[model samples]
Target: MFDLNCNLRRGISRHYAIDKITDNHPIVKSSKKRIDKEYSKFAGILIDVFYDYLLVKNWEIYSDTIFADFTTEIYQSFQKYSGDIPPAARQIIGCMVDGDWLISYQHLDGVENALDRIDYRIRAKMGARIKLVDAMLILQRESIDLERDFHAFFPELQQHILNFSLG
Candidate 1:
């Protein structure tokens, strides 16, 4: 099994995780669902969406990219219940670097999207907040020492990420 220790960051109830890839215990288990109400779902989706981009850019995902790619969900996770309850899926990001898997998550608190039929059980399903300025992340990967460059380059996303946490 892949060691999951030291692969997570949390604020209040929010979290970001970077998992070392493993063939023994795949980071994305075979018993999980695509729309499962877990926060990690968000991580899974993000890595997939950006897999080609990450590869084309040639950024070595350390044992710490916090995002990985695994494209298959032909199985069911543990949380599947007997009753046909409404699905409350969360958004997460996952990717691969040097064959290591990374995962990122955002809690679904204070989300502007109203839940019409979602129950409290799955309503707390945390996910990433789709930001308007994520288009600039492509530039952030250009350098490990992207200090002032990002601050000056992507002030909008930097501010939004900070403000979202504060607000």
Candidate 2:
């Protein structure tokens, strides 16, 4: 149990490390910059969600397993390890699974819904209003460049994770 806890902590640390790497990567920065100036402050957040959508959109290029099957396995894994996850994350996992969020990422409506939810949260927490829903228009307009950036960046991220795991 102690070893399991330590491993979980290590995994969480690796997750954050990977996020830092992604945030700092030049290609990701380029993708973020492609967003409209109105959304410059939320560029990082938008890029993160946009990349998830792209990953789902291009799932066949990256994974052999069907996307639905893959998402099912992920949800199951979350349930299996629910006891190890923090309470807040568990709640999020519940909502994610219930909403089929990962599967929904493949659709434009799902992406819009995600942006709307983020917009609401930002408004509530920061008392700052931004038209995040309109971000979909920018995403659609910049789809080609953003997709190209994702293709270039994702392989490098995968390699980095592999190296991190090996080290």
Candidate 3:
């Protein structure tokens, strides 16, 4: 299993540069809150939405270059934080990198396959079934809204990562 804590530590070490990351660091505290609010509880939906956003948005930052190259680099960087991710997620990561899945995830069939894989992994690793039908229904019904949300969310995330990297 990928270790979330370990990956977070690696991220902090790479970015925050605190002598030590304790429960007291603002980033650490904010991370906890953000994880609890956004990821810990709503990971699947957020992930799909984020994935869609990455694909559909214009992202002028990459106006002169191929976005696939950027995603390819990001995938390679995942090894730095590989400690915390689950084996299933690790498999998905491999598929994403090997398949250039960020671009593939933009297509309808790719989205379906991604959701199916997520559900399958959840069932296999957690012994819990996540009914993807409802999620799929939402995707079909609120795709526009979801795209708007992605447009709003992903750029900010990109900026944050960039700022963190530059810090």
Q: Largest TM-score belongs to which candidate?
A: 2
lDDT, candidate 3, at 41: 47
lDDT of 2 by residue, 1-167 (tens): 35767777877888997898999999999999999898999999899999999999999988899998999888987876789998988987898999998988989899998988788889989987687888899999999999999999998988898888888
* Ranking, TM-score, top scorer first: 2, 3, 1
Clashing pairs in 2: none
Sort every candidate by lDDT, greatest first: 2, 3, 1
Question: 128 in model 3: Cα distance from truth in Å?
Answer: 2.3
Residue 74, model 1: lDDT of: 9
Which structure is stronger by lDDT: 2 or 3? 2
Candidate 3 per-residue lDDT, tens place, 1-167, comes to 88667667767665553223222434323323332232344444434444454454554543566777777667877776666667987877877778776776556666666666666866787876544433555455555655555555555555665666687
- CA-only RMSD, every prediction: 16.8, 1.7, 8.4
Model 3 regions lying over 4 Å from their true place = 1-50, 53-63, 71-93
| Candidate 3, residue 100: how far the Cα is off, in Å | 3.8
Residue 76, candidate 1: alpha-carbon lDDT = 21
Q: Model 3, residue 30: displacement in angstroms?
A: 18
Q: Name the lDDT value of residue 50 in candidate 1.
A: 33
- The TM-score of predicted model 3 comes to 0.56
